[model samples]
Target: MSITLYALDGCPFCVKVHDALEANEIEYETVWTEAMHSDRNEVKRVSGQRGVPVLVDEDRGVTMAESEKILEYIDQTLAQ
Candidate 1:
């Protein structure tokens, strides 16, 4: 399974999501929107918003917006 997190470095919501992932020991690839121009558009296209902390799971073909919701979903989905 390939897990990707699209986020901007300075976003507090993104930081919270990151912290949640780390606390739960979830392995994921991070795509920084500020650093990667293409990722910004991709995130916007996928989530219909330019906000940070979008989570994408390629294996499951799932993309989610909202940091708090994403964290909860991740925790529930990967908790096994």
Candidate 2:
């Protein structure tokens, strides 16, 4: 399964999500929203909003916004 996290460097929520993923030992690619302007637009297009800590699970075909929910979903899905 491939997981990707879209975030900005200085966002507190983004940091929380990153820490959560690390704590859970979940492997994922981090896409910095500020650095990837084009991809950021794509994320907004798909999610219908511009938000930090957007998590995409490619294998499950799930994309979600919000840090707390993403953490919970990851924990539930990846915790075995």
Candidate 3:
């Protein structure tokens, strides 16, 4: 399973999602949104919104936004 996260530094929601992933011991690759101005294009293309803390779980075919919902979904999926 490949999990990728689009996030920016100093974003509280991003930090929340990251902490949840860490607590679950889930490994993921981060695409830093603050890296450059042009880098946000990828996030916009993937999610249709210019937001941080977007996550793509390739194996599950899930692309998610929002920290609370993403955390709940991950916990439920992991439980199952």
Candidate 4:
């Protein structure tokens, strides 16, 4: 998939990002991370930080973290 979302289960922030993508009808692959922050090595490697709700859009050459920023990005760029 061109877009990949790194998220943790039961995270509200992560849910927000996921909802944005879904609302926009964007297709993305999801990588569910471990509940413990220390186990989120893949998230850190991809996003430079182990934060839930990390978005990686290879097509846009974008990788970012934070729920609000990700939501903004989706609205500004990804939203149709």
Candidate 5:
């Protein structure tokens, strides 16, 4: 199972999720949100939304938005 995060550099929620991932020892790669329409298309393709800090959990077959939900999912799945 692998985890990927879609986020923006200046987003507070993105930073929160990143911090949680690090603290919980979750190995995840971040894909930045759009600098252009094309960059954003990937996020839309994956999650169907423009929200940053989306978490895609390949192991559980979940793609989610919102920082809190992402954090909660991470805590439940990997924080142990």
Candidate 6:
């Protein structure tokens, strides 16, 4: 399973997702996004928006934004 998290440094939402992933022992790759929304091309390419804490789960064909929803999805699909 390949999971990629699009995050920005110092973003609390991103920290939440990062913490959850770590607590669950779920291995994932972190794609650090730019601070400026206009510079977040990679995030927009996958998620249609330039929001931090975007999650791309290739194994599930899921690409989503927002921290709460991402956490919920992780719990439902990837939590042990």
The clash count for each model shown is 0, 0, 0, 0, 0, 0
For model 4, where is the 10-residue window of minimal lDDT?
44-53
> Could you tell me the TM-score of candidate 5?
0.89
Q: How much is 54 displaced in model 5, in angstroms?
A: 0.6
In model 1, which runs have C-alpha deviations exceeding 4 angstroms?
Answer: 35-39
lDDT measured at residue 24 in model 5 versus the true structure, 0 to 100: 82
Q: Every model's Cα RMSD, please? A: 2.7, 2.6, 2.2, 0.9, 1.6, 0.5
Taken over the whole model, the C-alpha lDDT of each candidate is 0.83, 0.82, 0.84, 0.94, 0.87, 0.94
Q: Summarize candidate 2's per-residue lDDT along 1-80 as a digit string, tens digits.
A: 69888889889999988998888888899988865555579668757777777988888989899988987887788755
In candidate 5, which residue ranges exceed 4 Å CA deviation?
Answer: 35-39
Could you tell me how far off, in angstroms, the CA of residue 47 lies in candidate 5 after the best superposition?
0.4
Q: How close is candidate 1 to the true structure, as a TM-score?
A: 0.83
Higher-scoring candidate on TM-score, 2 or 4: 4
Best prediction by TM-score: 6
Kindly report which residue stretches of model 3 are placed more than 4 angstroms away from their true locations once superposed: 35-39
| Better candidate number, 5 or 6, judged by lDDT | 6
Task: At residue 56, give the lDDT of candidate 3.
Answer: 92
The reply for model 4, stretches above 4 Å from the true place, is none
Clashing pairs in 3: none
Rank ordering of all candidates by TM-score, starting from the highest: 6, 4, 5, 3, 2, 1
lDDT of 2: 0.82
Q: Using Cα atoms with residue i matched to residue i, what is each candidate's TM-score against the true structure?
A: 0.83, 0.83, 0.87, 0.96, 0.89, 0.98
Q: Write the per-residue lDDT of candidate 6 for residues 4-77, one digit (tens) a residue.
A: 99999999999999999999999999999899999999888898888888999998899999999999999999
Better of 2 and 3 by TM-score: 3
